[model samples]
Target chain A: MADDSTSNTPRDHGDKTIEFSGLVCPVPLQDYPNIILGHGGGGKLSADLVQHVFLPAFQNDHLAVLGDSAVFQLAGVQLAGQRLAMSTDSYVVRPLFFPGGSIGDLVVNGTVNDLAMSGATPLYLTAAFILEEGFPIAQLKRIADAMGAAARRAGVAIISGDTKVVERGHGDGCYINTAGVGIVPDGIDIAPNHTRPGDVVILSGTLGDHGMAIMSVREGLEFDAEIRSDSAPLADMVAGIIQVCPDVHTLRDPTRGGLSASLNEIAAASGCGIVIDETRLPIHPTVQSACEILGFDPLLVANEGKLVCMVPAESADAVLNAIRSDKHGSGAAIIGRVVADHPGVVVAKTAIGASRVVVAPIGEQLPRIC
Target chain B: MADDSTSNTPRDHGDKTIEFSGLVCPVPLQDYPNIILGHGGGGKLSADLVQHVFLPAFQNDHLAVLGDSAVFQLAGVQLAGQRLAMSTDSYVVRPLFFPGGSIGDLVVNGTVNDLAMSGATPLYLTAAFILEEGFPIAQLKRIADAMGAAARRAGVAIISGDTKVVERGHGDGCYINTAGVGIVPDGIDIAPNHTRPGDVVILSGTLGDHGMAIMSVREGLEFDAEIRSDSAPLADMVAGIIQVCPDVHTLRDPTRGGLSASLNEIAAASGCGIVIDETRLPIHPTVQSACEILGFDPLLVANEGKLVCMVPAESADAVLNAIRSDKHGSGAAIIGRVVADHPGVVVAKTAIGASRVVVAPIGEQLPRIC
Candidate 1:
């Protein structure tokens, strides 16, 4: 089962197909050279690592969807049609506490957002902590309190947990893993593969705030107007949108790899093209300045609280109104649309009226930004 | 919010109550000093850590049950009575591979057995891995293969997963976190609090095999017949027993802290006393010899595949017969009985007809055995 599909073509350009024969090792381990922290940053390198290593090893139908959460039907003994969704993520963001949010809330909101992306009302979460020995008890308490508050605010219960303490030098301060189980409301089927050509893509709010916020603290960058992390739970916002329109095609949170990586993934999964107008893309002024100063692309930076959705053109206005009603989605905008041409490519219309292909970053622009 | 209950009394004797007037720091952080690996060893220290730290922070109704897995009812939109159970564990064993199994199968079986202890059939598991950079892909492949095989054998699916790579020196080769969701059958109310004074305690198989096996390999000890880890899945065996005796009070897989910790925890949770006959306690010759030579108590050594159940004396014979029918429980024995004399105490009746209190270990004899 050595499916060397990735080895044959090291790079994928939208719907275009390229192949090379007579070279068994098109991309060997040597080509990867070594796994950098960027491989875990949820960027192009992260996708490649999962595609080449994890997917082939744990091949399954549920995992094939590559959605933020894996949704399936669990036929109970006494009842049927039990649609449940499960997702897991590990948080290793440096500087446990940041300007607006810490790793604790990030872990809770990250997993919750993943479940909400699948049109599920995030229900229960299980947390696991890997702490290094000598980590202050007071700091652990602060993180736990933050997580508890986040869970309470998001309307999910922290049902069960496990804590493991590693040797002093073997681990960083702490790494948290949160796995969630949510109930996908009946009649709602949202997945990346469901995107269609005439779908209108809507973004919940601004981008690059979360990444730039973390970087400001990590790199000691001071700004007159501080850029705070966009780290908030999106389940209520998603539920609001679904209430207005249940036929939405896909919902994804622009996390580690940001909008570029998320849109590319959706395009590839649906075998369709995505075209967006750069002028409509929402960006806070401070975040824009920070990205420019740091030499980072706003499209490739991470966002913790925003979501990208592709809905039918007919229901786009109603869906946008519903999202705009939420405090977290006040800056919602229709940034893009799906197209039939160019299959899996994402094209951005620049302000000068020229179009550019949006490529996924091969590695993380900021490691451990989460 | 500061529950410093562990500080007052450093040690707990069976059926005794000792109180100190008002020492704010009963067991001050400085008393035990630094955090040791034994604190995560599932012994008294581990229990104390959970009691003084985790419970106070993430306090909720579900976690108070203190069962291997939390059993909760999820009301379905289409149908009702969707009883579900979930549990999470992180594996940080030093060596990835050992005699009977590796960390891969240990994670799978450990989680499955946990769900089984709550009388639930584990259905789905989500795996998250934290890999150290420079770790060999071949080794990861072997672990994944073992995990896939184990999941298949146990009749569970690996639905979704996440992978994160840490810098080389910051992490061990790999640490895995697995959280499972299972379905609890109707009318099955298995819990630690359900235990009664007259309940019969049954040991599924011999004790200390797993811990001894790991110690032998870690210490480079050899024997005529190699002692292997008793790491096997007990879901099927548990199902078998439930079929015959659905009134089982409690089921526990004695890992990390072994029978002593399991029995003590049950006694404390159920607020009852337990009395086990030494003559009836099952112990393999090799394991007994190894424990004796190593100056370790078999009751405090870990066992990955064994189980301890508290059933009514009337149904004890039937449950034993059912467990014996399974290959993993061929050596099942009725080793102990619950008592009403003293609450929250465990007494062992020796061959000489005298009884001695079985105190829980303050720390683990063998750390990271699971």
Candidate 2:
């Protein structure tokens, strides 16, 4: 009752304004009559859902930043006077396992990366498993092993966990929910809202690999060359950047909605414009052809192990070099720069020199891409 | 790979000792060749699953203690030099709403109580929702609203959350996973392993109310009186007891496997014997009758808001008085005491004077009661 609020912000209930406040008046999202798979795709639809549905319901200071992780200072709770970052994510990627990863590791790395986005060192993780009865024991063991291996690689402990089993048909094999806690250093203060006009945006690596990996496995689409899911713990890479550039403004993993949604989120959160060079976008040759064959945009494809950073222009080179030093960031490149004009917009400079708006897809181009 | 270990404890390789360490030789659990509803029922089967499955896979120092929550000290990370407690639980109760509570509040209180069991003051919670497509938005709003109220009641913030939607029929209406963090005051070290001989065990209130409440509504069982869920936040009550009796050895909410399981776990973990008086056990008449009619054991029925505290005999009276002072613990009673004999066992003194082994059920008598 205390949190319930009906937004007084006047808007054509039917209009396509990014309405952040209001009653759940079933104002049909002009294009989406029902929640399509894209709504969960981490694209424009997912963003809209968070902005229009979740934010209105749970509008708090920590959540207002719209960062991958919520970083806040818990005063007097600790002796070192350090801030803390906490995050939660549910992994529902279908097929469970694909070329390079499974839901188990995805569960760990997903939350780990979220903490990394806040410039925190992940320390502990909690896993909750929703299992469908009749699921194979062998499969469950495989997942657990992968989770253990992944946690070890990330130097975090799966300290607490829970498991609930639904009736056989009520659930797919399993859905994992993970929450993480990380300690943020005193000097580091990174969030999406901290982005400024002169900041430069850098991509940690290639895009579309994770989404296509899931799509290919689920749809049985085979390519001449295997496209593995680019799922890895990004904390080490993040630490590298922070080591050299502690004042980095923002860091986000371009997950569900691909790179476009991530850029748009930072743009909106900071009220700035982002201009990216299309030619500078890194896409593997096989991935490019596969996206073309499947009629999917590489720019809008999900990636799990990559990140986008908005750092001060002066710190860009050091940050880029620091990221490149990590094995996960070999494909790092400067893709864009923050601009003063067209605030709250993301633009892409075409290879031919014309600039076009890089709008986030309304929903996910591929479902269950993780 | 680092955590992988096969049991070194030698067994016949064929005996059914519920071997803790060994090969995954499918020792068919007598009658259960595969997972049954009872496997998830906080009974014997659930314990076995955790011991033979989860514990072996995720064996860590924190989990080895077997407390409702894992309390660990994060040194130098806090300014005031404090320890923190964290816990996670997934609520999959069917029917969504019962008489006194729903899965939403359960998600909050469950984790809060877990943190409380560690003698910590719960401060923050993270919620993750897995929704079934086509689930009425109205129902979701109702659930979220309930969660907000519960978090407010528990004096904890729902700081971060995630939402994932699965295709209709693939999931029940919704499954909520909540992970919580709390501040454990200095000099407070409460754990299952801390239970000592001569510790008096106190029951906060009536038993079997929550499970019976859910069972009645689900089975359409009519009763002379309504059985309301005993769902409330126990953190305040726990704090009350800790304030008066700081040496409270152990605290556990009789959830899942109910009182018998909680007692059994504490006994096994602490290597102590527990003797409980059946005559002192508090049970609502309506709930007792319902359990009788349904052929359910009251000892194995779940309680949501209630807790069992083990305190030194000298401080028992003060702890009991403090618990009774709290609204949620009005019916608090001393039901048992720790003993030097028969370590790792629980014995109930029957109303007729005979003592019987109070064994934890292998599975829940009622599925999804919590």
Find the candidate with the highest TM-score and give its number.
Answer: 2
Q: Encode model 1's per-residue lDDT on A39-147: one tens digit a residue.
A: 6777666776677776776678888788999997875454455588999998888899998999989989999999999999998989888888766666777888899
After superposition, the stretches of candidate 1 with alpha carbons farther than 4 Å from their true spots are A1-34, A76-80, B1-35, B76-80
* Alpha-carbon shift of residue B243 in model 2 (angstroms): 1.0
Give candidate 2 misplaced runs (Cα > 4 Å).
A1-36, A51-53, A56-59, B1-35, B78-81
Residue B171 miss distance in model 1 (angstroms): 1.0
> Each prediction's Cα lDDT score?
0.84, 0.83
Instruction: Point to the candidate with the largest lDDT.
Output: 1
> lDDT tens string, model 1, B205-317?
99998899999888888887788888898999999989999999999998878899999888888888899999998998988888888899999998999999999989999
Q: Give a tens-digit lDDT track for model 2, residues B253-301.
A: 9998889889988888888999999999999999999999999888999
Top DockQ prediction, candidate number: 1
